[model samples]
Target: MSAQAHPPVVLYDTTLRDGSQSEDVLFSAEDKLRIAKRLDALGLDYIEGGWPGANPKDDDFFRQAKQLKLQKSRITAFGSTRRAGSKVEEDQVIKGLLGSGAQVITVFGKSWDLHVSRALGIPLAQNLELIFDTIRYLKRHVDEVFYDAEHFFDGYRRNPEYARQTLQAAYEGGADALVLCDTNGGTMVEDLRRMIGEVTDLGAPLGIHCHNDCELAVANSLAAVEAGVTHIQGTINGIGERCGNANLISIIPNLKFKMQRSLTLDDEDLTQLTAVSRFVNEMANRPTQKNQPYVGVSAFAHKGGIHVSAVLKDASTYEHISPDLVGNQQRVLVSEQAGRSNLIYKLEELGIEGVDAKDPRLTELLLDVKELEHQGYQFDGADASFQLRVWKALGELPNYFELLGFRVIDERRVRKDGQHPMGAEATVKMRVAGESVHLVAEGAGPVDALHKALSKALRRDYPMVTELKLEDFKVRILGNRKGTEATVRVLIEWYDGRCRWGTVGVSDHIIAASYDAMVEAVKYKLFKDKVKPV
Candidate 1:
């Protein structure tokens, strides 16, 4: 199963267009341009910018995209066919596509007979005219024009002859590719494969665009490829309307490794896949799906004792491929389920040297970890906290500072306008270099005030602490049967410019948990910098 055995699949990314249709996903024109550059760097064949004339932002994106001069990817515009009974030249959708300033344009038209009658309120024969006229007109102006036979699978099933006629209309109009779309995402893989096989003799290159409502977009896309479709259309992380579009992130590795298909991106370029996925998530203001296949953090993470032992011996025992191929690394998670092998691997990964695996202290530390996990502590996402525990167990932890006491007070004040605003104040007392230091600070909340007060007390002796920045905070309640009395776990992420780390604390009190997590975050920063005890 060599890659050369199958024809190359072109990677068409629609993260800016189809992906934006997702709920809560709103990309500014600037965000689209930035993502386009990232997609270009990842070596995609086409980057669908967005629908010009739909909004000011999309129009602005196209105007700016022309200046990007992307190295590898061509900026593409997406829109619909001309409206019924309208001249192609007078159609605003068609006009927008021409003005988009894109080298390539993709136009989706009614392929299903039901959609032609109900959605567009037009005759099926006239819908074919729209598909043909739209692509034919655009092909004369653009370097390439693609026809998206929207709902082609449903259309083929309802009226097979009419569906083939729609494709033929686009082909007669000189479309570079007739892309079959599983727009509803309900088509089974076998049906899609058979239908695609029926259309290969249409004398035009074929492509596939699938959604994930059935959680089958990736599978269906692969099946289409196996049936001889060449072009693959998808978005990063599979974000789109409803469930999402097909995920190019997952599709690429499967195509190159499993399907034995050639790709324009060399092996080196493919390593950027994880980065591209995360960048899109960041720009979209969405959390990374840790369980996403191939590029997710948990994709290659081994958790159970047996899995960790086997993976350490030979990754192939559990993992299907080397994670590094996609720029992701294997992670061995430590939990109550961990064995000695898991602890040793984590210690080595943390760069804690000289601790013998057979040391009696190692057993003590493992027991402590199991007890703590039973008390609602999770070390998998809090590497800094786990490393600190290891150092404390080995009696190698440096005392950066000693906390003396802390107090927080929340108050509500009413203004003359009869509006009440709440505020919080904190007082912190600590010892550094045998000198007592005290500080008070005010913030919008108790945890924020506590953080300010602590930082204020430490800034004089350890000015480098000024570089520490809190990045994210998460809180989870364990055993919610107790309601407000439930033990809560707080996780805080910190960045000091050089690297990022997470620390965790668990307590029945939310404020206590947050303060403890904050303390660990600062301690980890000082420990990593190798600062001497003040």
Candidate 2:
């Protein structure tokens, strides 16, 4: 079907609702409001706020969400059907949804005969009444009512007749959309496509909600759309219970760019895909997957020499789509496996100009990278250190400060409470602007003490050095067999208000490795900001 002929697929985000069920994820009410506003900016059709009566956090979210001014998305309040044998008007769940002040209401009810009988301990016919009553009652108060048929796929496989009857009840009760949910997330794509077709005769607009247990959530969601469903529900970055919900981050681009399906998201909103994905992860305090499809850091990164060479000439040779289309950029990584093309591409990316690819110095620089990587120096994660090497190779590196010597003393003492407390002190000597300076500092640990001492020694001549703050420090043992004596590689990430950069150092002594990485971080900041010596 032509893109214009088919209706634009509605984007429903449940990150605030289902996504909070993920392991160790706790989004404060403030976090949900912020996420809702961001999703609204990204042009989502519906944002599922959460179940208002389920907990105090969601309750607070709904209370504060009243003040949020969203431009494009409708806030949805989710809840379950009224309890068995209870009046829909009197049910607390129903009352909570009515009081949530959301623009839409979505209620899920049992579709599986097993859940109706075993879980709810209610007859199949009574369960249908509950589904019909909850959606019917909510429809009177709200303009839109989306009915979620929980466990519909498995229920359909077990008792096809009962699943259809459940959906029919919701449709007859005036639901605007009937959402078929794969609660267990185990449905095969072929089975989903075939079953979804059978239910279309009901004449209700269909939606698809999927989980990722079998890792087919995205695939199954797309299959449903191809089967003529218009509404697609998912979470940002696919975070939810068990595996996760379907990832809209992957689904959005696939629908817009690959499957040629029209989406409610505009072309401009498509560009915010990566930023939104990362923002959700940040709020959840979860580590981002660097290899995640379109939004990952490694999605467009080329590591192989031949691949980099081809991509440098024409990106389409190795890329499936322009990374710019998703607000990402292609990267060439330098490593022991790097060829001349990798070096040239990386140097150009770092904005270091005037070096010819055929220059003899270029060959030497490539060999130096290989030799250093062989010694446990990885340039891929330490771009700042690699840029420094490029400057030194070009003979344009200036010495802003000279490290003369340093000493560290660590001591442990028993407190009155019988707790052992350790203290560390560092003394650093350096030459700055042709003057010798010595400073002593104490810190929580040896690395912190050294960083403080170095800052004190350099801050006189290089005042901007105060801007550099060590954000992260990681140490990896290159040779595990030697245990404590093994060579360690230290990577230090520094933030100087504007941005963050990483530098790497390798040595047998942990303190020396840390000090070297710290020095490289300072040097990179000085060079990049073009701070001249006093």
Candidate 3:
């Protein structure tokens, strides 16, 4: 059905509620408010704020959220349906939901007879009463109430009649939306399609929530949408309890562009998809997956000669959709497996013009890159290092600074003062412009002390160094060599507010490797600013 024929698909985000169930994905009350506002700005229909009274954090989140002026999305207070024997008015969870000051409330109730009997240890009939009375009761207090039929797919398959009865309770109770959930996330798309058809008479707007255990959450959600379900409930990047919820990042564009279904996200909001995805991943302290469908770093990256050549001529030649459609860009990656087109595309992307594809420097650069990669210097994740290599090949970069020498000392002692103390001291000597600068500093660790001393020395000559800061540092032990002989690979990520880049270094000594990566980071900063070393 066309979007004009049906209502725009409602986008319900449970990131603060269901997403927090994910392992290690806790968001403070402040984080929840921030994300809620962002999701609202993204044109979402509902933001499930978390279970009030379930925890102090969620309670405080609702409190703070009420104080903010949300523009579009409704902040939903989530809770479980009232207990089997408890009166809805006497339920503290229901009271908390009312007090949450949210315009909407969502509660999950047992849909599967197995869950009713095994988990709640309640009779099937009593579970239906919980689903009915809880939503019916909340409908009086809240502007909108959504009923979540937990494990609806599995329950429907196990006992189709009982599942429909549970949904019937929700429909009779006046739930604005009846959400079918794939709690186990194992239901196939065809089965979901079939089940959706069976539940059409439940008497509420249908929604779908899915987990990603079988890696079919996004597909299953889409299947439900195709079968006439209008609400799509999921989390950003699919981060949630088990595998995760369906990925809204993948689903939004899929519905808007591919299926031709209307969604809450407008053109501007759609363009911010990649940025919003990265922002959420950053808040979760998770690495953004480079291959994550539309928004990933490698989503539209091309490396092969034929692919790069065709892509450069007409991106539609190999790309299923324009990268910018989802706020992602086409990338030409240069590696040992790449061809002349890769070099040309990359150089042009970097704004290095006037170089022919067959230029000898291009061959030299590719050869050097392949040899370095063979030596364990990964340029793929180290974009700054790759840029430095490009400048070196193009003969445009100059030595910005020279590291004369450095010494690190680690000392530990028990003093007469009855104190056991440990400390690290680093001395750095570097030549900037035409003068030598030396600095010494102490830190909790050798790397920290070295970083301090380096910063101290560089800030005097290159005041712009103040803006350059290391965002992340990683060290990997490479090879089968034993003890100190093992190769140390250090990768450092640097950011100057306006941009961020990564560099890598490999050496036998950890400190040496770190220093090499640190130097590359500084060089990248200078290179971007059009500065060169004397």
Order candidates by lDDT, high to low: 2, 1, 3
**Residue 92 deviation, candidate 3, in Å?**
2.0
The sequence of per-residue lDDT tens digits that candidate 1 reaches over residues 1-534 is 567776788889999999999997999888998999999999999999999999999999999988997899999999999998799999999899899888799999888999989988888888888888888899889999988999999999999999999999999999988999999999999999999999998878999999999999999999999898999999999999999999999999998877778999889988999999999999999999999899999999998989999988999999999999999999999899998889989988987666787999999999999999999999989999999999898888998899898899999978999999888999998898899998999998898899888889999888888788889999999975588989999998989999999999999999889899888888888888988887
Measured on C-alpha atoms, candidate 1 has an lDDT of 0.92
The global C-alpha lDDT for each of the candidates, from Candidate 1 onward, is 0.92, 0.93, 0.88
Task: Please give the TM-score that candidate 1 achieves against the real structure.
Answer: 0.96
User: Candidate 1: minimum summed lDDT over ten consecutive residues — where?
Assistant: 1-10
Candidate 1, backbone clash total: 0
Clashes of 3: 2
Better of 1 and 2 by lDDT: 2
lDDT of 2 at 89: 98
lDDT winner between 1 and 3, please give it: 1
Each prediction's TM-score against the native? 0.96, 0.97, 0.92
Alpha-carbon RMSD, each predicted model: 1.6, 1.6, 2.6
How much does candidate 3 score in TM-score? 0.92
TM-score of 2: 0.97
Error of 3 at 146 (Å): 1.3
